[model samples]
Target: MNKPCFLLLCLVANGLFPVYAITPGQTEKENPMTINMSINQQTYEISLSDTAAAKAFVEQLPLTLNMEELNGNEKFADLAHSLPTRQSRPGALHAGDLMLYGHQTLVLFYETFQTSYSYTPIGKVIAPEGLKKAVGDKNIAVHFYRD
Candidate 1:
């Protein structure tokens, strides 16, 4: 086997690597890393990305943050600790994108817009129609937890 493939096999065999399956009509609840994000009294399901940063973020779950509003588009808070990052510019951001900036800042976008700044993927909120109203135009306390 090629060296890279052999290493991957070894990692899998040692239970040091994870494998995911994509099935037809699979729901977010079926995803092992899915989490609930609560703003005010409304809850949104977040489908976490398959990345090291997402895994690290999940490890610190059941957290509450007083996220500060920024630029009339997003809310952000500094994590108590840092996570691993694989940053990239996602040119167009949707309303429910949850991303990590640098190694410590956790950002939640509530608007659709283009950007040149790079961020690490954390997750995306499902059905975020009421999100903006829940957050309002001020800093809000948000909670994240696993069901």
Candidate 2:
């Protein structure tokens, strides 16, 4: 079996899937963890991934970070602390990706492109359109919160 299938089997074998029931006509799953980012005075809701890095990041939420531009495609900032990470490069990247690079740097991609760099995927912007425009090259304060 493929890795994803095997992982799912492991989760089911260990009863790791959430016990919450999915009612009829309800397509959206409950997300107890969420992150809010205010960039360029606009708020964006982000759904966090189930990863150690993501959890560590949420613990220090409500932060105002001065995001620096990188390669004209993404903005990044160093975190106050490092998080657990597995180095695996993604085939492609899209706008609105919140990622942890080398366990220390927090990267937010506002442009879609490919990369060979390995990063821990944390979450994504709920609404991705206009994200690039909102996060221009200029350094801007990105406030993060649990709200």
Candidate 3:
């Protein structure tokens, strides 16, 4: 590869320059964002959805809290402030689906399950298969930050 081309590729690979990253069904206008989640002293990268709610969540970055175990399938923590919500019903919960319950609680789904709740979708996890094991059936301190 040429010198300039190699440098450009390096930037994109490091997430500093996203030239044409259209995330699956997302439009070309949707820019990708990343978040970091820490549990058991380990940090995992999470890919966030491009939305107003997700943007708000990002603005509240570097938040730390103890997420409580829920229903054997998810972990949740209450946010100090309310996040703007886009009311929508979830058909099924999937691993790594970050969400907001009501306006104050943040939920991270780790197992698939049917649900009858409407939540503000925030983001999703995109790598490393050990997330489910990290968030087991116990309360854990989660450190969230924009990555």
For model 1, name the residue pairs that clash.
none
Best by TM-score: 1
- Model 2: per-residue lDDT, tens digit, 24-58? 42443454367899987899999887778888888
Model 2 has how many clashing residue pairs? 0
In order, the Cα lDDT scores of the candidates are: 0.92, 0.86, 0.85
The residue-level lDDT of candidate 1 at 141 comes to 97
Error of 1 at 118 (Å): 0.2
Worst 10 residues of 2 by lDDT: 24-33
Best by lDDT: 1
Q: Rank the candidates by lDDT, best first.
A: 1, 2, 3
Tens digit of per-residue lDDT, candidate 1, span 41-129: 89999989987999899999889999999999999999999999999999999999999999999999999999999999999997889
TM-score of 3: 0.77
Candidate 2, residue 83: Cα displacement in angstroms equals: 1.0
Tens digits of lDDT, candidate 3, 1-147: 999999989888879755675566475246477889888988888877767888888888899988999888888999988888896888898888889999889998888788889998888888747888988789989999975
| lDDT, residue 24, model 2 | 41
Clashes of each: 0, 0, 0
Q: Is candidate 1 or candidate 3 better by lDDT?
A: 1
